[model samples]
Target: MKHLLALIFCVYFSGCLMGQQQAEWGNWKNWGDQEDGTYLNPIIPSDYSDIDCIQVGEDYYAISSTFQFSPGMTLLHSKDLVNWEICSNIIDDLTQISESLNWTRMDRYGRGVWAGTLRHHNGRFYLFFGTPDEGYFMTSAAHPEGPWKPLTPLLAEAGWDDCTAMWDDNGKAYFVGTHFADGYKTYLFKMAEDGKSIDRKSAVLIHSGSGREASKLIKVNGWYYLIFSEHKPGVGRYVMAKRSRKLAGSYKEERQLALPSCEAMEPNQGGIIPGKDNNWYFLTHHGTGDWSGRIVSLLPVTWVDGWPIPGEVLPQNIGAMKWSGKMPFKYTEKLSIKRSDDFDDERLAPQWQWNYQPRKEYFSLTERPGWLRLKAYRPLEADKLLKAGNTLTQRTFRKQDNDVVIKIDISNMKDGQKNGLCHFSSQHSAIGIVKEESACYLEYRKNDNITRGIPIRSQYVWLRTQWGLDSKSHYYYSLDGDNFLSFGEPYQLVWGNYRGDRIGIYCFSDKREDGFVDVDYCHYK
Candidate 1:
């Protein structure tokens, strides 16, 4: 209540642009990075981890890891580092990586695309990402919002993750990647002139340290800086920097640049981007977090004696700082990922992502003029919703309560088909309606346990899931749009498979792939 009043006061007295306020993607009051000079810790208060940002002219393009989500490699663009909008997704189809993504087993939950590095070189946008089990891959496009050329597998061997690409002043390309096979070691590999293939014979040890990964190569003022992350005793995940005059050998010993932060510990594992004014900033993710997962934070970077310090360094080399400081660039506009979906448009919003590569024929927006029609298909197995394909999902929030409402039409549902909205994670819960032999019933699934057979005569009903910041979830249902009655026990939202909790709309069958559900709209507030 107080927060709402405070939000109202700030909206009124602070002269926040009404258009910008109306375009907020998530909770209004918790939006980070204010227009004032000083910005907050989390520039984005959601799970946008394994982030890498590159400055291309005055525009900034950033990419985040999307493990199994189809249209992977979430690309975000910003005029200022503080404000960003979803620009594009580099990988339009997960099947391009492996057909296993669409397998009946429905694999590749946390094993698909990992941390990626984005860079602009010679008027082309290049992205390099790795799979923990499938080695490294590269893709390129003339524009950041890309019809990115298909993923070219650079290295087919396993045990590599978090790779970055760069080209030296001599026109020779090099790739910096981490190999976990022989402990945590960062490797430097020479790349082909085109940057698609790496010379296997040119692999060299760049840096090796405990928990060291997220390797990136940055050149500044004739000195080459190799940035990485490490986990130390009692300090958590921290950033490390090593520098040398040359690109390959004779690098300096690692220096601790930043330490675990109180705002969200383990403020680690992100690349650095410089402002147009030449001011540098470190883009990091808080490794320690709740159901919001690893949220992103942008910290001020200062170069002291050739080392890039993330945030402010404390006395006695204790830890790095996490405080709101002066913005490196002017905050002129506000942007966010589009969230709400009325299903009235020809396209789905950027906030919508499939659990994996969705079968194109299983879902449609054009089939039903003004609704999202999800054709019900049998689960890969008996009754596992996680294995159910075409589950459209969006990230949930923390630090504030989130209300999700979805109106599902069951008029076309068939027996043995269950279609409704759910909160999904390692442990998931759903308040959905099921069509049985002769009638429809409301059902609830908590974890693996489920309760069904609550009769509902309506052909259309509204389902609601209230996700509290404290991780509690309340499920409700309504025949009419007005009043909502709590149906199930409070389910605790959880984190699993390297992802935060996601509120998703799913339609699957236990019998046959012969049913469908028309969703009028899904509203999140």
Candidate 2:
């Protein structure tokens, strides 16, 4: 009897331990901090593309292209290079820059706010970015998280992108960018000290190739390194470098710096910055698009004979891609980019952004105190998810399987209003409450196809989307918020408009605009 009791106790103890371990680590899909002094590749497994990072004091600040998403150019802050969080968004109203970015137009799908450079000099932070149609624009702030000055047009000509600026030792500013319309030709020009304008008359053609772009200029050890990406015939986009003793002209022949691996597609289009320990590191995004978009990775850097080589150095001075390495700094706290919102705060979390410049009158956090109230509005294009205005969204993580559950109150929903959760790229899938006449029904929409389920009489319903590594999503709806029934067909997530899949909460009406839904909370994992 004693032996049997001891066996049972041991079994119970082990089961509890296993359950605790699963609860701690099982749900997370994209945790990079190993917690053992090492970190993994794709430090951020979301769609933060066209990245540029800089070290300001002990804190590291990085920025990424937002494309058509409003709050253009996301800015991130990190204590250690492996752990990052959204600090702020540079452009709050993208319509201020171009009317094409307005929700009514929604035309700048893959073109607005492309690759940019972030630099801190003279006690201020400066950001320079360009659009394919709007040429180049810049903004500056006293701090990384800031009241940024209104964007000043640096150049108003089209066909230019991927702009970087550097202030030399003598305080002379220089700008480098690529002109895609002109055979991918790269040029260097003198920039004004204020960084508000560029001296186009000082333009000098530096490099030209079949598909050369993503220009970054930096000075290290008295050599000005011009780093960019060029398309290889069959190998995809790869990082290349050209060094010159002077800022202009006569650069050495380009050398291959980093190449794509089977796991990381095309390690290109990012900046190299010195770590806190004075060692250099390269933060880049995989150029090739996937369901997760261009995910970010941090590569170890080695200075070989005055050249900064990224990843493992191979023969002929090329860097082979790596998957894991020692942590740049010994940061023990596990940080995440995922958000769980309770809707109690006065402001939305930094991770949230509208599909475009939202019509602020239709969204309210104060309307219901502890809930997010989204009033329905007629979309510019009727019955189109992509054309809906005021849809709040955030990037979906793709490292492993993940899920999101949102509780919404549909009591206030009016006829012809659709209120629910959705995940979309170019195409979209949604599971939500669709009201018709005087009854509410649960509807699952995949692109244009609609599947209506039984009538829902509840005031509140919980909607969930579970997505796996296969890039497929399954949706569920629950009345009690405990037991959930599958609602939609297996929807495949996709990469489009140069963006990864984004999960959003939408409330819109195809008819009148008097309906509304209150989102109680959103739990994402």
Candidate 3:
């Protein structure tokens, strides 16, 4: 097994070295390709973890776990698996699931909608996810980019996570999920024809092991294959599979399909999708991550004696694998997540996500014609950005370096209101304009410590934050859009709650709820 893995890695990387050079590395938007058909690992440079992918005809849709960001699930679309774009979202508001998300006293953090499965079944798209605290929930849409229906709680019981749904050959439907409450056992339960509810009495213990979850049932060549990931002592977490002629019990032997590479220690938890040519490929995430969070990668899967071994299994380089491969399909065009916003559109871009279920009445794009108008509303309880409701944000892309700038018109601001641009996560830093009873001042906030009274003479200010690959963040402000000046100290951007940091635009008041700010534009480069 190890030799086969090494051979595969050497063959692919050898091909990659022939055309790609070192100087071309570190560009996030163009990370995957040599521009000559070969591609690299971590096709995506940012944290797009816990992905579930499905191929519908010529198009592919992948959804990722978004912990507390409103519009719970991130939907991505791709023509060739190497390039992807943020296309749509699964849920509009998470308050539909639990009011605890909206409670300023409590923040879900890294505990909201988690690892989910996306499947195209019977003319509709079904997406299912489970929260460790809130049990299982499912939502469907006739179209992937959709006006999706409200969420339906499949089971009110907690402790179940990483679920997948399947329909067998006999027209019988089954739901497979893992129970964390009972020593991490994978269970299979019968489901109604409509796939809305599970029959608990028909549940059977199919697999039991440590760190075993993300169970997916696939039928190929007259066999029911149970694919899952498990963690065993020194081996770390690896993908495994078991097969049977029947759905109930008495499944066959298990096979270790794939292991971590030296560069990617935990390349676990993703889906298998076949290409247009009928070749199989595995889309998984590199688990050991920096402050930028887990990044997703695509690996080729070859069947040896009916077992799918993804990429190479290199024992000598236990933490390394082939970093590039020939494109599974012909290249169409390069694509990536959207970062810049002109605020000229009638609807918010798919890239924008609220910190939580936003107070719908506090923001508007049409109010100022070409600007995003955010009304300042006092927090229900907490004063921090993590718990502050209705802050619009998006993930910070992990690369060599990046800059974010936003122009805010604070002429509409009232006394005691603060509006600013922030880099937010469990720990956050912000540079913004704060209005006091007598005057306005520029403030820098980090670690709950404030350095205020840096007097700025204008109501219109451009706030900027630049984050580097080293995880250092620098702040600046400009009265004129071009002449920017540095401020305070350099802040360290960090990650928490199973999420990377986010660039956020926020508006809120300490005394009243009627202040407002008009953001003319936000640019990312």
Candidate 4:
């Protein structure tokens, strides 16, 4: 009896400890939820750019662009707009769109999947996104968490972006998009009911201007509203909207909806979603590019004389940004974007993505239990880290400071193989092991510059990168799990390829595909 009682106590204690650890891990990053009936701005301080959101019966879903990354189009779910969690990724294999996105080529950089839309219609979830080189493509699912149908190309012509779809009351489907090939002309095209094709002859010019794009269409209270973004010559990007009683013509002259707040990046290019209590909110990203990418912010929408004004209404009818406000709903669930991974699960975390569509055979989670095994292979371009295959990555969230640490087992490393952790945009920096001629040496690489450190014989090492508000990154490594020693010169993280910095684990061979590394764990905070 005493033995059983002691066993019960031990199990209960272990469970509690695990629960505490998970709770702690979830709160490691700067989450917007204050847990006290109000939330903060930059709701998600990561690279979830070019966002579009919709609300469906008390639940909110938002989709963001994932350019040149495998598992494109990240889908997020939330009870309130401020707090969100990764629910699904719409595109699992980007190579379906084009082979140029494949791991071997590494061709597309800033140009793969651009702005798109997400809408729920008639018990189906539909997504439409575009590539500058490959035109527009879409996919649908019966449920948001889905076995999504394969992508179907809707338009084969290029130089189009920011595509959105709407089904009218009479069930006539319409598609709206911007044609950058012709100086930012926004057009409305009648789409077939099946959504597989568009009648090019039915195109109608809705709005046209210099630097006009990110168009969204919605019907509210017998009015058709078209919201979009335009770049001012000296002022940066701003949000604008026009409304009409008809979908095809006679939209009023566009009015300014929102602009940049004091010292903040321009607020532009997102969705306007209605709240549960007839209130409304605008989900937008800061348009000016920075090292943190385009971080998202939530603004309160106030309808003034039939115009849904986002944020605080100021002179000239533009809305001022709000940094914090009452929760859209009074729910208490604290959600966060998943970051750390233990490599114990059979599948990769939804937050993780390869730099491009990776070669499936080059990576495995089951090869070594409780570890992620990445088989080394030669990059398409020798000594080019960005051209390497199977580099697993996730967005770097902005905070006062952020740190990422990973434990790597290098016992299987071969000569000419490099295995380590990295943070990169166009320029990247990494600290890892370089196996050369029967000796293992610590190496720090910043772009094409390589700094070789002392020789080491350790079979396992812990690599870390620390970056802060300045967006400068410093790399360190440790033979033991603790006592890390800095190795590389500080690298300034940049905004490139339409993406912010990403932290990743990489393994690549400069010569042959005969080496591998096992990453036991990754902790980000």
Instruction: Report the error of model 2 at residue 1, Å.
Output: 80
Candidate 3 lDDT score relative to the true structure:
0.78
lDDT (Cα, tens digit) per residue for candidate 3, span 472-515: 88999999999999996888777778877788998888688897
TM-score between model 1 and native: 0.91
Clashes of 4: 0
User: lDDT scores for all predictions?
Assistant: 0.79, 0.84, 0.78, 0.84
lDDT of 1 by residue, 1-525 (tens): 322332333334225433442243223354466666778766787788888888887888888888988788899988778878889888987777788776355787778889989988888999889988778888999987778999899999888888888887888888888887778788888898798899988888877757788887889989888888776553356677788888765675657665444334567788787876678888877776567778787887877777787876545332354546666677556777666789998778777888888888888999889999999887887678888888999887775767889998889989999887898877788989888897899899876578874799887899998876567889999999889999878988777888888889999998988889999999888
TM-score for each candidate, following the candidate numbering: 0.91, 0.93, 0.91, 0.93
- Candidate 2 lDDT score relative to the true structure: 0.84
For residue 71, give model 2's deviation from the true position in Å: 0.9
After superposition on all C-alphas, the RMSD of every candidate to the true structure, in Å, is 8.0, 10.6, 4.3, 12.4
- Model 2 quality (TM-score): 0.93
List the lowest-lDDT window of 10 residues for candidate 3.
18-27
Instruction: State in Å the error of residue 89, model 4.
Output: 1.1
Winner on TM-score between 1 and 4 is: 4
Tens digits of lDDT, candidate 2, 127-155: 99999998999999998778999999988
Decide which is better by TM-score, 2 or 3: 2
